[model samples]
Target: QFVLPDANLGVIAFIRLAGIKADQLLKNCPKEYWVPGLTYMSEWSHQWLDYVTRTSGRLTKSVRFCDLGDFKMSMLEREVTRRDGEAMGVMEDCYPQLLQTVFLCNASSWIQVPWRLLRPIMPKRVTSKFEIISPETNVHERKMLLQYIDEENLPTRFGGKNAVWPVHFPLPEN
Candidate 1:
């Protein structure tokens, strides 16, 4: 059986369709490590052939930031090189600032939602607020927020959009 911790809720729904016991699998993992938002899994029967050929490993801390900078740079370099040398020169002039602005905007939005949400969850802890002081809220605020979240070592990528927001849900009374 393939186990995923704190995986997306969808996996549970998926297991139900195949008459597999999801609750038992979930019970095997510790409560704190089970990130309900991040976990995802598929039944062994659905793709048995692929499963037989593949190797699986435990989800350790090291698995989390998989050389993202190198991967991104490689992709960018490949795409640029695919174009003619003259085109690459033009792109070099036009891309860096524009790309930086886009990344900043996405990061800013990520930081803002958590700031508003986390206050109710962890009231006593320090909270980072995203200020929209500049006309370039999409650019400047986002860049600032990305830097702040990175320093805190929070998970940032949520399906290409940074999910820097912290989620807190109250536990059920025993």
Candidate 2:
């Protein structure tokens, strides 16, 4: 995932996620490294928060675009889910209310199973912010996402003109 260079409406950050084989990539790591891995993610989250605060303002928040275009069932293994839960917990602990919305794009019907199980467990504050977009409603959801994020800030893959990932730019100052 990477943040867009420009903030949405000058205050909201646009974070884009590219679908990747995350489970395969991390499943081989030993359990001993998990803590350090979460720490690294925390540090990265701080950098992003700092960037938004500096570029926009202290009140700036984020909107995440989770593109599951290449997602597979194997990616939802127990280990991956556990790691993800830990990382999310850390983020919430470190920066509450930093996320304004989460757009789950290109989601298949398989997602409903997990969403059903997860939704009841998640706080209303968190669950209410999520917006899932399936293949059937891609066009409509794209319009919805555009309502919050300007077309210029969105990446080409998400119906915007920005083709480059923000990683190619500079990292936020520590």
Compare the candidates by lDDT and give the number of the best one.
Answer: 2
lDDT of candidate 1 over 95-152, digit per residue (tens): 3221111121222344446655765676442222222222122344334433323322
Residue range 1-174, candidate 2, lDDT tens digits: 444354423223333333445655576676667756766755665556666677666555566677766666765667766876877787778778777777777766788678978999999987888877752246666787776566665666666656765423344343
lDDT against the true structure, per candidate, is 0.27, 0.62
What TM-scores do the predictions have? Answer: 0.17, 0.67
RMSD of 2: 4.4
Q: Which candidate leads the pack in TM-score?
A: 2
Q: After superposition, how far is residue 6 of candidate 1 from its true place, in Å?
A: 26
Off by over 4 Å in 2: 7-19, 54-58, 112-123, 134-140, 147-149, 163-174
Model 1 / residue 123 / CA error / Å: 2.0
Global fold similarity of model 1 (TM-score):
0.17
